[model samples]
Target: MKLITKFVLLYLVVTIIVLGIGGFVSYHIIKGELDNELKWRFLDRVERVTYLLEQGKNFESPVQDNDDTNLKIVALPNRVEPNVEIRDTLVWHDRLQQMEHNLKLVAHRNVDGTSYRITTYGALVESDDITEAVIQILLWILGLQVIGAVGVGFIVSNRLFKPFRKTLERIKNFRLQDKNPITAEETSVAEFDDLNKFVEQMTSKAITDYKNLKEFAENASHELQTPLSIIKGKLELLTETDLSPEQYQLVEDSQRSVKKLSRLSESLALLTKIENHEFTGTEEVNLSELIKDSIQSFDEFITLNGLTVEADVEDDVFVHMHPVLADILWTNLFQNAIKHNVEEGNIDISLNSQRLRISNTGNPLSSTPEELFRRFKKDNVNSKSIGLGLAIIKRIADQYHYTISYTCEDGWHTVTINLQN
Candidate 1:
């Protein structure tokens, strides 16, 4: 979840819990106060009736001030001890034809040895009034909370987090080779300022380290090429001199080894250059034309190996890319399929607007296809492959944000490259 969303949700939850507790407690407190007030009113009415009776007033149907309050006098069956009792009771209402809830206060006393029951009642109206008032109050509180929480949570938080968001965007756009430093708008928030500073420092250090590594790789590769060439030349000269059969075989093997080493060094240098994004310039190139040309160039090799080549290419599958890299990518893919196939194997090439697929009849891969994309990983260990072809292909695909995958089924190995728009 986003920071603003989480903060608002948490605030709302806490506010609800607090309001629920406060409302519950307030409800009970108001109810208690109303109960006490009702009881005292009933008690006072009972005292007035007692006083009237002691004054020798004749017993009659006593007057009721309101339907909610009543006074009644009843004769006891026998002389009872003097006492007072108060409780809640339900009285039937003649007019309403329903039970009316009331608080009944009764006083039992003897006057001249005559038993009399004097009772007073009061309706429980305070509870209903208090409840209605409390509900209205809670509604107001809830409305205010909704407004305050949403408005303050969204508006204030968005303003407060703006600096952090900008800082994060700058950090995400930071590139190791780019010389620009990460920056954001100045803010009063100290933490965001500190974060931007840290990000700038870190990116600067990363760019410096990357430059050092790239320069070293380029210099080392350039420096090794001259010595390798000199060694090959010397070996070629040595081969021409008079020598025994065994020595000649040895020299040939040495020459072959030197050639392999030279290829490996060149591949490594090319891989380094690809990673450093040295091939930044791009042009419109027709991939279909390139594939046909590559096929024609490899005709001799294919014929000598007794391999059959098939091409099902669409017309004018154009792409914008570095011309050299595109050539390398297609060459490596074609060579990979050819070099790994069996004798008299069939190579099928299919190309359309969206994808290019190359399938070759070959021995079942000893290693998984996923591992073949790692540097120096090969399916056929007995083959004379330096094992960097698929690795180079994968790096180029990644550079263009394209997808490449391999699959093997029924002695057929397929390499698919998905060209994205």
Candidate 2:
């Protein structure tokens, strides 16, 4: 749930409990006060009736009394104890022809040697009636509170969360390589302000780190190229010097090692560039055409390896990729296939709208299928292979969010590439 929603619900729950308790207390308080009021009204009526009796107004006859409309006063010619009594009782209403609850008050008085008893009755509010009344009042109050709470939540929640929503948008669109990257937006709320401040610090640090890393990669590649080129030149000159057969063999081995080192450096630099997103230019590449061209280019190598080819490339199979990266991806794929293929074995290539699969007849791999995509991982550790070809292919595929899988069965190594988004 949203924070605003949770908070508002909690507040409403508390309000309901408070109102419920208040209603309960209010019912009892009001009922008590009303009972007292009824008693006082009954007592006042009794006093009026006593005064009329002293003035010789006969209360026995309704016409002669001229008072005590809701009272029954009677006298006995004997001395009796004087006291007052009040209670609730049920009485029959002659006109309404029904029984009704009432507050009945009785007074026994010894006035002028006569035991005078005066009774007064008042309409009583039943428990159910009083409860209903309190509930109505509480309902009205609760309804108003609910409406007000919802209104305030709607009004305040949007305003309060506006900065938070904008912060989310900023984070969503943030790009480390963008010239103008996202920075934290200023907010009035302390929590949101702190969040924005932290975001600003982290983004600033990330941009600084990215710049340093990218600069280091470029500088390192350039610096290494110059020294490697000079060393290669010196080795070529050293090869020209007349030397023993053993010395010449050593020179040849050193030259091969230097070339391998040069290639390794280039492959590593390419991997770094791909990771850094330097291949930003992208276009729809015709995979079918590219693979056909690649196969033609490596035809001599395939012939030298004594391998047979079977290509079922679908026409105009397109993928969104950088032209250079596309070429590198296919080149690495074809190279891996040919370099690992057995003599007089078959190479089967399939391409369609969904995926591309290349299966080459080769010896069973010594490493796991997953290890084929890891850098510096190879089937034969002693081979001249730099162990970066499949790694580079996997990295390029990953950069474009493509799925690449490897499988080996029956002396056939298969690599599948799915480029669909």
How many clashing pairs per prediction, in order? Answer: 0, 0
TM-score of 1: 0.85
User: Once model 1 is optimally superposed onto the true structure by TM-score, how far is the C-alpha of residue 64 displaced, in angstroms?
Assistant: 5.1
Candidate 2 Cα misplacement greater than 4 A, ranges:
1-157
Model 1 per-residue lDDT tens digits across residues 1-421: 8887788789878888888888889998876677688788877776776787789877676656554477788878899998889887887877668776667788887876788888887666644566778888987997899889889877866798888877887777766666676754567988887887888778777778888998898888889889989989999999889999999999998888888888898899999989888887889989999999999999999999899999999999988889999999999999988888899999999999899899999988778889999998987777788989999999999898889999999999999999874
State the C-alpha lDDT per candidate.
0.85, 0.85
Each prediction's Cα RMSD?
A: 3.5, 6.5
| Residue-level lDDT tens digits of model 2 in 10-73 | 8899999999999989998987888898888777777877787778776663223234336766
Clashes of 2: 0
